[model samples]
Target: MTTETRPPAAPPRVDTSRRTRAPLHLGWWLAAAVIGLTLLNIGSVVVRSPNLDWSVVWEYFLSTDVLAGLARTVELTAIAMACGIVGGVILAVMRLSPVPVVSWAAKSYVWFFRGTPLLVHILFWYNLAALVPAIAVEIPFGPTLFEVDTNDLITPLLAAVIALGLNEAAYMAEVVRGGLLSVDPGQTEAAKALGMTHRQTLRRVVVPQALRVVIPPTGNQVISMLKASALVSVTSTPELLYSVQVIYNNNFKTIPLLVVASAWYLIVTSVLYVVQHHLERRFSRGTGRG
Candidate 1:
């Protein structure tokens, strides 16, 4: 009876008169700032156009040769990325192997390839036919079984693919390794307790989870590969930059031809960015709710 007479708990101390400021719309301010910056940039470009002809730029981009070059650039990127993914998985496994020799070999490969500039690697591979006169097949520390002329075996296109794929693999191995490392050790333990072998656990439990980590960086790498395909021009593979160069060399409209190449690169990069965004969202779905 005494506890019931406690003055109704002071009306629960409700602060009804307190004023709350409305939440600021920072997004609107950010949009305005972006618009201002874009206008400034456009003004600067217009001001800097000494003897610029917009028509020539448009014409160059619309040309059949430029379209052909774009197609070839797409082809090179597809081939290189496919080869890179396969090689990267192999190298990543090698790097993670319990055997010291396999790990050492993988480490050495990454070291040498990553230490050198990719452009240099491309050039070296292009000239590898001269450096190594024959492509010989033999058992380790045994007599040669067969030989093919290096120049015949390695075409410039093939050389470009090999160089791009091998170089990308060095970088991609690290990406994959990082993804694999991110998976919880407990998951592997549980998989083993459930009678899964190491390889089976890795393939089933580890890689699926690792893919969530691996895919974003791999998308970025694909975008980078798209740009790096230009380097194939050095080997006369007639990719986008090479085709543009050929056009400019003939017509001497260097700026316009470059603009064409830049436009295509921009378009491709934009598409890749869109793909990356969706992929990141897909992977992030379950992560945010908890």
Candidate 2:
């Protein structure tokens, strides 16, 4: 009663005039430094008078073979990503399985694939025909089925796709598992209470919710896979980089050819970034304080 009588406690001393500011203003300082360094670098390049031939860049872009190579690159990315997503979902489920054996197997698969460098995986797949001369099929604890020649069955393209997809699946499995784990247990419980089976709960409740958490990283993975498609050139898959190498090797226009490939990569990645922004917004809507 005495405190309440003390002029309403000075209105609790709200510091309404306290102007909050960032302690360091580091962002503005960093931006200015970056601009200064970039200008300096550009000035140095200009002073060096390095040949900046726009005509060669244009010619490389307009070339039919380069266009074909670009198409093949896109095709490879799509196929590999499709395979990776499917394989990853299966692996994620396996890893989360109640059975110890299934979970262990999934963990081992992910460990082996992820521990190994992707380039090595690609090389191994390319040489898989040499390692295992014949491919055999047999049911578990059953007689062997008809066998096929491994070398004959696996083309370089197929090997590249398998290698990239399987390797990517390992990483994507972790991403998916993380997303699934991020979802509340109550969601699954609620779905089960509503008479949904485990599979139905996962499909209708879990995956849809997890996808919001998954899409950003998955989109980044897709972009990376597009770039990684260039690695197939080591196996002579005639993808974007391989085609550019062929052109330059013929005409010795190495710089121009590289620039062409770079331009296409930049353009594609920029478009992908825009798509990713829209996808993130679409998925994030209604899931939060938005």
TM-score of each: 0.82, 0.84
Error of 2 at 223 (Å): 0.9
Off by over 4 Å in 1: 1-50, 138-146, 197-200
Model 1 agreement with the true structure over 186-287: per-residue lDDT tens digits? 999999999999899988999888988999999999999999999889888878999999998998888878888998999999999999888878876768
In the range 92-190, model 2's lDDT, one tens digit per residue, is: 999999999999999999999989888897888889978898899999999999788887888889989999999999989999999999999999989
> RMSD of candidate 2 to the true fold?
4.1
**Cα miss at 43, model 1 (Å)?**
3.9
Give the TM-score comparing model 1 with the true structure, all chains together.
0.82
Task: Give all candidates' CA lDDT scores.
Answer: 0.89, 0.89
